[model samples]
Target: MTKRSRRTHSAGLKAKVALAALKGEKTLAELAQQYDVHPSQITAWKQQLVEHAADLFGGGK
Candidate 1:
């Protein structure tokens, strides 16, 4: 049997998927299916986006 390799996603891709999740146009399950990521991962990204949004404005972490 062959071993399956782990997939690595870029930050930009994760941010894009998380943005789509924050938009509320689609459910987490649907987003997961479309992006090939787990719903929990999407949720974590979304939460991170919200929590760190202030950093984008130079508010600092």
Candidate 2:
């Protein structure tokens, strides 16, 4: 059997997912199911958001 390659999401998509998670509208598991991604991936995205939040305010696009 041939191994299937893993699919990768774009940076923008990851940012969107992280923003949704930060909004507190849903739990990490819920977000993960909604986005069809792993819970750990969502956690990592959220952590990155927390770490780089300052950059967002600094207008560093």
Candidate 3:
């Protein structure tokens, strides 16, 4: 039998998934299913977004 390779997602994809979760339109389980990732992973990405959201605009021009 052939071995299955581990799946990996990029930062952009994680950010997109996190944004979708933040929208509150779907449950975590649904998001996980849609993205084909673990719910905990999505939760971590969402938390990271929340923690750094201000940084995106906080930089002084």
Our tally of clashes for model 3 stands at: 0
Mind sharing the TM-score for model 2?
0.77
Clashes of each: 0, 0, 0
Residue-level lDDT tens digits of model 3 in 1-61: 9997898889899999999999999999999999899999999999999999888899833
TM-score (C-alpha, index-matched) for candidate 3: 0.83
lDDT of 2 by residue, 1-61 (tens): 9996898999998999999988989999899899999989988988998999898799876
| RMSD per model, one decimal | 1.9, 2.8, 2.7
Residues 1-61 of candidate 1: C-alpha lDDT, one tens digit per residue: 9996898889999999999999999999999999999999999999999989989998694
Q: How are the candidates ranked when ordered by lDDT, highest leading?
A: 1, 3, 2
Model 1 TM-score? 0.85
- Candidate 2 global CA lDDT score: 0.91
Question: Which ranges of candidate 3 are over 4 A from the true structure?
Answer: 1-4
Off by over 4 Å in 1: 1-4, 59-61
